[model samples]
Target: MIRVLEPPRLAAHRREPLLNVPPVITVLAAAMLLIQLVRDWVDVETGIEILALFAFIPARYDPSVLADGVLPGGVAADAWTFITYAFLHGGWAHVGLNLLWMLAFGTPVARRFGVLRFLSFFAFTAAAGAGLHLVTHEGELVPMIGASAAVSGFMAAALRFMFADGGRAWRPGVAEQAVHAPAPPLMDVMRDRRVIGFVVVWFVINLAFGLGEPAGLVDGSIAWQAHMGGFLAGLLAFPLFDPIRRRPGSDSYSRTSRF
Candidate 1:
């Protein structure tokens, strides 16, 4: 197993907290939910749909707020819609869910890949997701929004972080090792296989959801294409985003004496 140098010292300075730091995903999700609850109160004074839906990713719905559109099926003429559309969402639940996923997995991936790179990849995936949606939907105001595309990319990166062979493991030292105990199976699933499982389930479930030719839950606006594209982006581009720090043969770094 990997060795811990000291009680306080860490291996490297990745510049951010760990993925589950402060359980950020949970906090963000909660905050979004709270904001949604307060929307009605704010609407009276603001007089605008504060958190209403806006199709912002593949194409920017003309109205900046929700409940205001009978949009065209094609792409937005302006290129910036690719960026703006990501901010819009169908509902509070959508925003909360997507952000929660991002925080849950996005933070750690950000740690490995630099923050800027993570943001870039995230945007690229969002755009790519939209492009995929456009290809599949073809000429209809599908009205898409949410950070699912970027989140998918993050999920892919996280899976690789977890499962790819030949990498560093923050192993415990003799003392910590002496007191150590293995975690339960469920925890192991959470620590390791969660990403892989998520990827598989996400792909299959979404694909199945889209099986009726956009007639099921997706309802003629399934962005399975975007999900796939974003996933592929995360799967393939992780190394480029965060070049793996090789230290001799990663295979041998762990202590082999332990049984």
Candidate 2:
């Protein structure tokens, strides 16, 4: 009897879910959305009051303003507004744009940094943004609100490792590995042509926003300074937050290794 040879069946293809966002990202997004909803539900006066209480107003630190007690929340507001302002936004448009960028850049960061590190990084960047805003717009009464600065920071942090190890090309099913891959030293990253190009483009866009807003070419004033501060902080402080330790005499850092 002759037995016929048959081809082996192929394994079923596993599909990745469309929305593979980390839980921390989801929770942060929800919190911002909920805050915006409450702000919208309140009356105009209450909404303004909310901004006064939570938004980062440069004038809050002004000696005269502090003495007058014009702003609510007092000393507590002085302390909390650095991060609380990130949760507030001008409107749905502002918050929606922020959420979009946050998801795009924050996913990889959250995945790599884990929960606590990511949260601390977020607060650090937000505070840095607020600090810079105060410096640039000192004693200004305008309240700065939005998550753009922190989102910008996430974008900067992601850049540290996104292009490492031939990751410049996008390949399906390997995104997880790409983000978790070891990052090059900051000096090497600065020298990389790809990284340099992205930085130039990002700064150009911010410059355009800064110029256009004053010319009435843009609708709302963009807090580009705050964005710059957060981005710079993230780019420089990445090593501190990175769990991956670099092997001595090696160009790359690894998560499995010890310092």
Candidate 3:
């Protein structure tokens, strides 16, 4: 009997684990939802009270409020509001939009930065955004609430690494190809047409919303200043948190772990 050799079988293409996203993103979104539920179903007055305590309110630092002394149940300077306010939101739509943006952009940043760094990035960017809001509208009495600042930060960070080629940069194949393409320099990023275009569009949208909100053209309040602050913080500060990793092989970008 003659022995016959058989051809080796090719490995089946494993589906990319797109659904296996980072857990932190889900947790952050859940926290927002839980807070919103409490605000809606719990006591409306009590919820507002809680929001006043935790939400970022520049008036908290008013000279009169300071001279009157920080009252227990009244507005007072609370340093924690910077990070705490991000967990609170105005309404379902506000929270929903922020959560969606976070899930989209935060996942990649969290995957790249890990749990600890991601949390730190979120907190710092949020604080920075609040600071900007304070500087811009020091006399405003309204409380600034929502995760837009942190989400904006994540957006800017995503822009740094996500847009490898252009608007078509994030394609699965393109991601893999990025392993070979050197990460664009900070300056080069500004020069890239895609980046420039995205920045311009984002700036224009925020400006329109910011200006229109006061004119009563846009519904609800939009903390456009906070968004800009967060975006700038994430864009300028990403390098500090990012780990210095050598460019991976051409195929490495395709591997979900690179995310």
Candidate 4:
């Protein structure tokens, strides 16, 4: 089927600064959780306990493996938890804010990097976040969950895309970019300080929230660790997934991140 492009979804053209990928996913991710929250709230007694289910920790699935470490001591639960926790939410507000940030930054980065690249970055960063948590809360059963790792990856990708070479040049059509056309309304506001500032604030808030959440709440959420892991992973891995880039004169910018 020949898929028609949605004007707003395009990310290749330098029309403005549309957040094509990450932000949209962020919005969608949060929306799904929100719906679940409402449903659970309506029937509190039988809706599967919001706090535990929404959090994404593997132990929540069986509770019998709570005492085990992620790999050395427990079942293969850790393998799945590494990725599954990403979808789990904590509260309505928690998911809501995370989605907001994801949309705020993810879309633009996706626009620049394309879909597959974004997904790769998201997955790796998520794993990294879990890895960090595993190190700190290895034995206590923190039940770590959420998109903080992926979201932080977006931030890292954005930094690389925007700052690597004065932020003016961009690679178009690296992946099968469906939405590559220009959307002036969306693009125009992207470069504004307000948006950039918001991203910075997003990081700060995550750091603060990580400090206050209860122990064993989402694997003892060390939000900073997730954020840090994601950011670093994005920076290092962008070249692999960020479609090959070529300089204006050097024939092509190496898609590989040698710099």
Sort by TM-score, top down from the best: 2, 3, 4, 1
RMSD, one per candidate, in order: 11.9, 11.3, 11.9, 10.3
lDDT of 3 by residue, 19-70 (tens): 6567888888889899988888878688767766787877677765444444
Enumerate residue pairs that collide in model 2.
Answer: none
Error (Å) of candidate 2 at residue 102 is 0.7
Please tell me which model should have the higher TM-score, number 2 or number 3.
Answer: 2
Query: Candidate 4: deviation at residue 118, Å?
Result: 2.1
| lDDT of each candidate versus the true structure | 0.51, 0.79, 0.72, 0.54
On TM-score, the candidate that comes out on top is 2
Ranking by lDDT: 2, 3, 4, 1
Question: Candidate 2 on 45-92: residue-level lDDT in tens?
Answer: 998888889988898899865565878988888999999999987777
TM-score of each: 0.57, 0.87, 0.81, 0.60
Q: Where does the lowest 10-residue lDDT sum fall in candidate 2?
A: 1-10
lDDT of 1 by residue, 1-259 (tens): 0000032454232222432343434554465466546643464534133312324332233343323343332333335445445554445556666776787667666545544566677778777777776665554344555567777887776666443322222222221221122212222334555445666798887687545343322213445566777777777765565534334544322221211
Worst 10 residues of 1 by lDDT: 175-184
The TM-score of candidate 3 is: 0.81
